[model samples]
Target: MNLPPMIAALRHHKAAVTLIALQVALTCAIVCNAIFLIASHAQRLHVSSGIEDDALVWARSSGLRRGDGADARARADLDALRHLPGVTAVAQVNTLPLMGNDWSADLGVTAGDAQPAVNGAALFLGTPSFLGTLGVRLVEGRDFHADEYVDYSPFDDTPAPPTAIVTRQLAAHLWPGQPALGQRVYIGAGSSQGALVVGVVADVARSAISGGTSDHDVLLLPVRTVAGPYALRVDPTHRDEVLRTLPAALIAQDADRIVTDREAFVDTVHRYFHDDRAMVWLLVTVVGSLLLVTALGILGLSSYWVHQRRRHIGVRRALGATRRSILTYFLAENMLVVGLGLAIGTCVAMWLNHWLGERYEVPRLPLSWLGIGALLLWAIGLVAVFGPARRAAAQPPMWVIRQ
Candidate 1:
């Protein structure tokens, strides 16, 4: 049961012991980070887009004009889409959750010469029906009145919107511990006119933008986009029915220029996160492969050690050492080496995480993962050493002495 004799025996084979420890350390660091990334991607996949995913469908370019007629066409199309049998509400907006259309803005509490507090927020330009159409829950304040809606053209002179609605995430960040209602925020740098915040919604997901940010930061302007997708809130059962005949229905309203295929909002979400889904599966594969290789490495090394020490094992058995004692000795030796590697690997894992954070914006590795990695490796080492230890114990002292 004494560790010094076993430790001294290991000292004679420093090169082999060191190689095994270093291999374990490197594997622990890489595997820990890989598993962390897999978990992160899984979380992203399930994040709420905060839209009525099952009840909404959208279409784009159902009659868009570059200049004068764009507004009229949008108007006529909106009226006709509103009259569809299964359609409950319809509105035109610049973008929706997971639409892959990136439009961001910088906004803050003041309008003067100071750096803004909120940045990289998804900027949405929508009409009065946008809130109803998207089905985002308005947690506080009121929706824009019909009179509050204004016309906007990207190619022409478009006035700043008079009112704005913000997500609950952005509202809390900008005005923490206070009411967001009636607070005026400057849209851009040095804008004397402030866009009044009239409402706050529960949450809304955003597409990836230039600077990485939480996808909850979104703002809605009351300016109806002249060129934008028409979002229709329809019955869940009627999603396919609506997508089937929406084109012909738009043609009936004379907005029949460049009408793309109508699609459910949920499909847009799936398409947007295609890369993330792939990365998750890839990371999972890497983790599995590493664990398998590490287990096999331990098994091979233990078997080789038992072969080299056969005569020593036979001498102890001739002196009346039990089979259980021989098995315990090999297992304890393996644990000693693996424990040393785990200590070194903990430091290596943190260093790896810091480098990843600086290079790829990965979050700091959680401390719990170290414990998990150690426990997993410890269990693997025992199981791997058990087979070799049993084979060594089964050899008779007479057979070994004759060899």
Candidate 2:
């Protein structure tokens, strides 16, 4: 339990001790941040799209010959898609969730306000069957009536419709304590008139995932539009057949229009988050490898120390140092080294987190994660040094003196 001798003993091998401490420090810092990133990515990947992803498929068509009545062609395409076997509902939508394209509007409580109350809520334009097609549950209010539907075009300079549907998250954000229905929120930067929140859906994720609570912030407008793409919900048992046949059906409706980007909704989501999934696994692998290397480093250092101090251990054993005392001494020595490394690692982890937050928009490392990382390293250090300590404790004083 004496500190002077152990501190003096460590001083003899300061270079090795310092190197191992630095290695442990580096491992601790990276593992903490890596784990945070992995969790973030995992949460992102698992975010709810708030739709019938399994039964949904979307297709896009471009290269349409101008003056071929593009709007009429879009309507015909929708009709054809709807009539196809296994099709439940189809709609022309401006954007689908997780497709990486977002049409957002600045919303204000009052009309013509200079600053927005909620910024970057996704704007979705679709037909009256939009909710039905996407299978989004209505939590409050009512869906857009067929009479309220408007024909919209991206090229049109008209203002947005006066009636809109909002996600529950956006509704809560816009009106925290009040009923969201009948609440009017203005859109755009200069618009004086606002849209009434006629409906509130359970949830709808934004097109691009964000760090804030705005990930589920969305507003829906009942407008039949061909500016983006078409989404159709079909029988899950026939999803593949529908996907395979729908493109040819649309092409038949208009050969001039080129069919592009046909895939199931779930597949599209998977494709969008493929890189995030890879990063999660990659970070996991790095964390595992780093911890293993740190454990081995601790084991190697403790083993070397045991060999170097064999005679010293024998002398201590002769002077009434019990086996338990020898074991406790090595464990205490490792605790000191690990404690120093953890202290350095905590600071380095924070600094690295600050850099990551600024450069890559990652969240700050939580203090709790640092504590967990420290505890994990401490356990690793103890386990790694146990065997070497046991051997040191079993050294026979008589045998060492004869040698």
Candidate 1 minimal-lDDT segment of 10 residues = 151-160
How well does model 2 score by local distance difference test?
A: 0.86
Off by over 4 Å in 1: 152-159, 209-213, 254-256, 394-403
Considering every candidate listed, which one attains the maximal TM-score?
A: 2
Cα distance off (Å), candidate 1, residue 305: 1.7
Alpha carbon lDDT of each predicted model: 0.83, 0.86
Candidate 1: RMSD over Cα atoms? Answer: 2.6
lDDT of 1 by residue, 142-193 (tens): 9998888887533344556788899998888888898999998766655566
Cα displacement (angstroms), candidate 2, residue 325, comes to 1.2
| Shift in Å, residue 40, candidate 2 | 1.1
